[model samples]
Target: MAGPGAYAAVWEPGRQNVTRYRLTPRGWPEGRRLRLAILSDLHVGSLHVPLSRVSELVAATNALAPDLTLLLGDFVASRARIASDPSLADLATELARLQARDGVFAVLGNHDWWHDEPTQQLRQGPTQVGLALERVGIPVLENKAVRLDTAGGPLWLAGLGDQIAFLSRGRRPRGIDDLAGTMAQITDDEAPVIMMAHEPDVFARMPDRVTLTLSGHTHGGQVRFLGWAPIVPSRYGNRYAYGHVREAGRDLVVSGGIGTSQLPIRFGIPPEIVLIELG
Candidate 1:
C-alpha cells in the first residue's frame, strides 16, 4: 500500500527511500539535451509533511545536475498553511536551493489557492519561494512560456496555472484561452515544446503540438495496490499513477511527488524525484 505522498519503494542503505526516474524521448531535436528534474505535490505544511524528506529530495535533484529544474505546483497544502506559517518560508528557502543551468521554473498548484488572496497577496506565496530562487537567479513561470535558446536553436518551456485554482476565480480559460491555445503560440520550427501542468488529468485537452507534458498531482495513487491505485481523484482513472502514458499521441509523465496530503501514510508508494533526459 502507498500513502498520499508515496511514489515508489526501493531498498538501499542510507538511501532506502529515494525514488528516481529517467525519461528519454527519442526523435527529439538533435544537439539539444534538456535534463529536467520535476518535483510535484509538495504539500509543504500538511499534517504529514516530513521537511527532512523534502530536503533529501532536493539534494537528490541537485545531484542529477540537470539543465533545468521544474517545480510542478502544490507547493503548499492550503491557503491557511500559506497565511499562518512563516516556517513555510523556510521550506521555500530549501526549495530555492535546487540548482539548474537554464533556470528553475515553477507553477502554482491548487494548494496555493487556500486563502483566496488577491494577486498582490497571492504574489507572496510564490514570491517567498521565488525570491529564494531569484537569489540563485531562478525564475518561476506561471501560465506562461519561456524560450530557451540552446545549442539546438530554440526550445520552449510552457506552464499552465492550477486548473482547480483557475476555476475557483470564475475566470477559467476555455477553448482558446485554455492550455491548448497557449501552447499554439509556440512555433513548431522551434525545438520540441514541453509543458508543465500540475495535474496529469489536464493533459486530456492538451494540444498535440506539445511533445512531452510533465505533471504531478496524483502522488501515484498515494495508496496503491498491485498496479491499482484506489485513491486517485483524477478523471483519468489509475492510468495517471506514477509512470509514462500516451494519450491522443502525446507523451505524459506524471511524478508520484514528495510529501503527503490529507494524511501521512505510505505503504507501497514512497516519495520520488524524476529525472527526464531528452534525446
Candidate 2:
C-alpha cells in the first residue's frame, strides 16, 4: 500500500510542504501526554528511493523529540534490484539512527515480502534485518508485545506480523491474537494500550481494549482527486487512507508513510512522518 516507490503523496492544506499529523485522543489520562512518531514503507533498494531521504526523515523525527517512535513496516523493497543489492547495508544503517524516548518498535510490510522472496527462503524474512536493527538497539516486534515504563506509567505495546504473510502462505499470519493477551499481562493502570500494525485492514476486527492503534500502508491511495482517493488497496478501502478512524470504540492513526516504492514520482500525495500526541 505504499506509494509508487515507498512514500505517500497527499497534500496537507495550508502547509506549504506536506505535513504529518499530530493526533490528540481522549481518555489518555491527565498529565500523560505522549508524543509518538510513526514512519513506514522506506522500500530501500529501489532506484526510485534513496537512503538520504530516510536519513533526512530520521533527522526531522529526532528534532521533534517524541516520547516513542513506531515504524509500521516495509523497511526494504523485495524487488529484484534491491533484493540483490548490497546497498541495503547502508539503508539498515540509516534506519538505526532514529531516536525516541521510550524506544523504536517496528513491524514488517508487504513490499518486504515481495522483495525478499520469502517463499524461496522459507524462513522468517524479517530476522535478517530485524537482527540488524537490534544490533543498533531497535526492536522489531512480530506478533509480540513489550511493555515500556514511562513517566505516565507502563505502556503495553503489541505488534502484529505483516498481514501479507498470509497472502503468500495461504494461512493467517502469526500474531492476530496477540493483543488482548498482552493487555491482560500489563499491570499499569495509567499508561494506555498501544498497538503497531502495518496494514489497516485489521481495523475491521480490531480489539477494543487498546486505547489507540498506529498503522501505515495505504499511502493515502497515492493520488486523490476531488478530495477522494480512488485507488485504495487495503482491506478497508477508502476507510484506510491517512487519518483517524474509530473502530470498536478505539482510535486508529494510519500514517501516510515516508518513502516511495515502485515509482519515485508523487503527484497529490506527499511523503510524511506523523507525530501523534496521546493525552
Candidate 3:
C-alpha cells in the first residue's frame, strides 16, 4: 500500500549508492592502476540531497578509499522546486571532507552557470559555487588542465566549461567551453589524459590522446524505468544518457549522479556516486 508510494517518492530519492567500474583505457599505463571516485550532479540542497546527505556521501566517498576524487559539477539545485536548500557555504563544508590521495578536482555544470546571475551576466569569472569549492581547497577547473604525478605515471586532468552554460535567460544559447584550449594546456605529450566534462556530448570530439572521459548531467533520466531514461538533457538523446561507453577506442563514463534536476523524483535509477578504477 504505502510502501510503493514511499519507495518512489521519498525512499528511492533519498538513497545513495556507489556504482563501480574497472577500465583499462587505450592510453593507460600497462601496470599502473588509479582508483577514482567520481561524483556529479550533486544538486546539493535538492529535495533529497540535504547537507546531511552530502555529509553522508562525503563519508561514503572517503570510505571508497579512492586514490583520486573528481566532482563533475551541478553542485547547486537551481531548478528543483524546493522550499529551501542549503547555502553554498554550508555545502562546501561537507564537500571539503571528500578526500583523495591525489586531491579532489572539479568542473562546472550547466546548472551552476545558470544559477549565478552575476556570472551569467558577465559571462566570466567564477560562480558562487566555484568560489565556495575553491575556498575549501577543491580546485574548480573551467577550461583548464592540470598535470598530476601518480604512481602509474603522470596523468593529465582536463576539465571544460559547461556546454549549455548560456542555454537560458534572454541571451542566445552558446557554450563557453574551450576543448582545444584545455587540451593544449597539457604540455606533456605522452601522459594519459582523463577529462572531466559535465555533458557526455563532448566525448565525440575528444582527441585520440585521452584515456578516459567522465561526465554527468542526465541524472540517469532522474526517473528511469527498466534501465532506460526517456528524458535525457543531452542532444544525442539516450545515446550518451548513462553508463560506460566505448567508442572508437575512447572510453567514457556517464554517471547517473546523486541528485535530481527539474523534478525531485527518482524511480528506478535511484541516486549514485560513480567510482572508476582506471589503468
Candidate 4:
C-alpha cells in the first residue's frame, strides 16, 4: 500500500550523514583532545542495508581520521527464518578497513544475539559475530574493558553485552548489564571511561565513574515527524532515543545509527555516523 516516495525512502540505505559533537567529561584531563568515530546498528543483510554500503561506510569513517573507532552493535538483522546471506567473515573483512589510532572495538546487539530467533533456536550468532570481528583484528568486548594509550592520555574503553540479550534467550544471557565487572579492569589513575552499550536504557543505571556511554539501538525511532518519533523501542520510551543527554553526572551519546529495523523506511530521521570529540 506504500507509494513510490515511501519505497524510495526505504531503499536508500546510502543516505547517511556525519554528526559531530564535543564533550568535556568531568574526569577528562585539561588541554587534551580525543576524537572518536562511532558506527552502530549496521543491520547488514537487512533490506536496503547491503554489503556494498559497508565499504562506503568504512571509507567515510576513515576520512574522519578519528583517534578511536567504536562499533555499537547489531551487525546483522534478525529474521524469523534463517537463510544464507553475506558471511560474517566477509563483513568483518570489509569493516577491518576502518582506521583508528587507538583501535576499533565492538559489542554485540540484540539482533546479533537473536538472529536465529523463532526458527533455528540457537544462540551462536553472537559468538560467531564476535569471532569474525576478532579474526579481523577488531576486539569484541563483552562486559569487558580495555585501556588505550591515546595521544591525549590514557583512556578507559568499556563495553557491555546487549541489555536486550539479558531478557532474550541467548548464549550466557544475563538479567542486567555488569558495569561493575567491566570497570573493575581500570585503576584509579586511569583516564576517563567511555562505555559502549547497545541500548541507552543502561544510562540511567550507570554510576558517576563512567564519563560517557555510546549507544545505538533505537535508530532514532526509525521514523519521525516534527522532530518527534512515533514509535521507539525502549523501556524509557523516547527519553534515551537519540542525541546527547547528560544524566547521572555523566554523558551519553545515542547515535541514530546506520540501518533500520522492523521496517526499512526512514522519514525525517536519517542514518548517521557520530563523530565525538572529547577534551
Candidate 5:
C-alpha cells in the first residue's frame, strides 16, 4: 500500500494548479491593468517533471493570455546536469509556444548555474539554459533591466543572477547576482520597477524604489504543515518562504513553484503556475 509520503513525493507533485493573486503596488499605474504569468522552478527532467510536461505548461500559460510571462529559472533538476535531462534545445522548443502581449522573459536560478559546469566555471556570460531561452526568442535577463512601455505608463523589469551560482569558489558558494548593478541599469527614475530574483532572501534589502519583486527557489518549502514550512532553504527561514508578502509598503510574491528540489516531496503545498493581476 502506498503511504501519504509516497503520494506526496510521487503523485501529488506532478499535478499542476493555476493559482491567482491580485496586487496593486504603490507605484502601479492607476489606469493600467497588467496580468502576469509566473513560471518558476520547473526543474525539467526532475523526478516528476518530464520533458513532455513542458508542452502542458506552455499550453496552460497561453490560455491565460497574460500581459507578460516570466520564467524564474531552475530549468534543470537538482543533483543533475542539463546534459542529463531532455536536451535544452528540446525544452526551449516547447517553451517557444508561450505567448504574452509584452512578450516572455527569463532569468537563471541556482540549479541552472550549478548544473551547467561551463557557465558556472566561467562565472560569467550566459548559462546553457539562458542561451536556449534566447534562441527560442525569450529574453534572458542577467543582472540586467529592460523598460517596457505599458498602457499605465512605463515599467522597468530587472533580472538578477542566481544568488548561489557556484557551489564553491574559495570555500564559499559564490553568487553572480548584482543588486546594485541591476538597479543602476534602470534609466527610468519614475517608472515602477519589478524585479525577478531566483531567491527571495533579497526582499529584506529590497529598496523602496521597486514597486514589486517576484521570486522562487523555496518551492514553498516543498512541504508545509498548517502553513508552516519546516525546512526553508532561505537564510531568513520562513519569512520569505512562500506566498504574497507586503513589507514596508512594497510587495513580493513568491510562488509555490513547480517541481521539488533537494527532496521530491510536496505536502500542503502543491506545484503551481502563478497568475498575478497588478493594477
Candidate 6:
C-alpha cells in the first residue's frame, strides 16, 4: 500500500490534463465544426480538490476557446462538513469566469445531491449549490433542453438530473429527471442533440435522436493498475466508467473528472478536462 504522502504527491489539486476527441456525427452540418469543453467533479471540499483549484480549472477551460462549455457536477466532496466550507461560494465565483461562445451549461451529480446522510434531519446542499451556479450565470439543466443557434446551425442541448436523487431520494426534495419530456422538446429539425447526464449508465436508455452524451461521475476508477480499475461506481461496471463509447450510433464521452472521492489517491488515472470537437 502507498503511504499518505505518496497519495498526496500524486493528487496535485490544481493540475489538469487535457484530453481531446474528434467526432463526426451525421447531424453535424457539412462544413461546420463545434468545440466543446467539459469540466466535471471538482469536489471542492476534498483534500485533493481544494476550492482554490477552481481558478486554474477555469483558466485552462477558457484557454481552449470552446464554443460551448459543460459543467458536469460533484462541486462538493459530499462530507457533512461541506456545508460549512466558505470556499464553496468562492469556487462558484471562479467558475463564473468560464467563457464560451454559446454559453456555460451545467448538471448536478450524486455528490451535489448528497446534502445529508439518511440520519440527518435536513437536506439543503443541492439547492444551495444550484443557486450558487445560477447566480454566476450557469444554467443548471434538470431534465430540460435548450436550443442554441450557432454558426453551424441550430444545436439542441438537454440534461438529466442526477440518477441517485431520482432513484434513492424519491425526488421530493428535487424534481425527478424526465428524459422523455426532455427529448420531446426537440423538434423535427433533426439538429444535433447533445445530452448532459452525470452518470454514463443513462446513455443506455438514450434514443437514436441523441447524437452525443457527456458525463463525469466515475473519476476514471480513481485508482487503476494493470489496466484494471478495482472499484467503479456504475451499474454498467467498467463499460461506461471512462472514455468514448458508442451505442446504437449515439456517442458518449465520460470524463475522468478532477478531484478525489472517498480516498485522495490516484494511481494511473489523472484528473482531466475533456475537449470534444464535433463535425
lDDT of 5: 0.89
C-alpha TM-score for every candidate:
0.79, 0.82, 0.94, 0.90, 0.95, 0.89
List runs of model 1 lying over 4 Å from the truth.
1-27, 47-52, 82-88, 115-137, 151-153, 166-177
Best-matching candidate per lDDT: 5
At residue 46, candidate 4 shows an lDDT of 75
Please write out the lDDT profile of model 5 over residues 62-103, one tens digit for every residue.
999898999998888887664567989999989999999888
Question: What local lDDT score does residue 228 receive in model 5, on the 0 to 100 scale?
Answer: 92
What candidate 6 gets wrong by more than 4 Å, as runs, is: 1-14, 116-126, 166-175
State the local distance difference test value for candidate 6: 0.81
TM-score of 1: 0.79
Give the lDDT of residue 162 in candidate 4.
70
Residue clash pairs of candidate 5:
none
Tens-digit lDDT string for candidate 3 (1-279): 688777877889888888989999997888998999999998887778778888889999999989889999999885732557788888888899988888899998988888788876887767888999999899998999999997566899899988888755686567889999999899977899999999999998989988899999988777777777889888888888889999999999999999887777788887888888876
Answer with 5 or 6, whichever has the higher TM-score. Answer: 5
Error at 43, model 4, angstroms: 0.4
lDDT of 6 by residue, 108-221 (tens): 887676653541234333466788888888899988899999755788999987777622354433435678989988876667898999888889898888888999999888
- Give candidate 4 misplaced runs (Cα > 4 Å): 1-8, 11-13, 80-84, 116-126, 166-176
Candidate 2 stretches greater than 4 Å from native: 1-26, 83-86, 118-120, 123-126, 166-190
Judged by whole-model lDDT over C-alpha atoms, candidate 3 comes out at 0.86
lDDT of 6 at 157: 92
- Candidate with better lDDT, 2 vs 5: 5
Point out the worst 10-residue segment of candidate 3 by lDDT: 78-87
The Cα error of candidate 2 at residue 247, in Å, is: 3.5
lDDT (10s digit) by residue, model 2, range 1-279? 654334323333111223555444545766777788888766665444466667777898888888888888877763655335546557668878888878887877776655555543664554456666766677888777777886556777888776665343766444333545545565656557788888888777776666788888887775676656877767567887767887556788887665555544455666677887666
lDDT of 4 by residue, 185-209 (tens): 8887657888999989889888788
